[model samples]
Target: MEYAIALVVLAAVVLVIVVRPLLGSAGEADRTAELRAELEAAKEAKYREIRDAELDFRTGKLSQEDFRRTDRELRTQAIEILRRLDELD
Candidate 1:
């Protein structure tokens, strides 16, 4: 009976060792997914800002120089976000 109990305890330990990583990976996957979603949202928001900036320029709300600078900055940010998203894949 003592031997049986020891065997059962060993099995439980082994099972935990194996299953713990699987559980941790599930959490990692969730975090990765959340990060991806956040990145995508940021990318879209950047695009919208670019569009809005263009509109403002056309409507004369922003000076040409201001628009160009804003456009360059927004594009750079969008590129970085895209790069991060690609890295996730």
Candidate 2:
């Protein structure tokens, strides 16, 4: 009977040790905030590139064909980046 009581106590201690971390709330919020910031920065950079390309085209710095090609490329890149962000979420 005494050995059984000791065994139960030991089991209880081991259980607590193994389960404490699982019981606590993990740092999910911090990770989400970091991911959101990264997404926001990427979106801003993508838009900035598009705007710069448009301005250059308007100023006659790029021909119409070149502008259309660059516009397509930038839009495709932006879409891919957004798709990756969706996957992360």
**Model 1: per-residue Cα lDDT over 1-89, one tens digit each:** 99999999999999999999999999999999999999999999999999999999999999999999999999999999999999999
Q: Which regions of candidate 1 are displaced past 4 Å?
A: none
lDDT of 2 by residue, 1-89 (tens): 99999999999999999987765535666776788788879988999999999999999999999999999999999998898788777
TM-score for each model? 0.94, 0.66
Candidate 1 displacement at residue 56 in angstroms? 0.3
Steric clashes per prediction: 0, 0
Off by over 4 Å in 2: 1-29
Go through the candidates in order and give the C-alpha RMSD of each one to the true structure. 0.9, 3.9
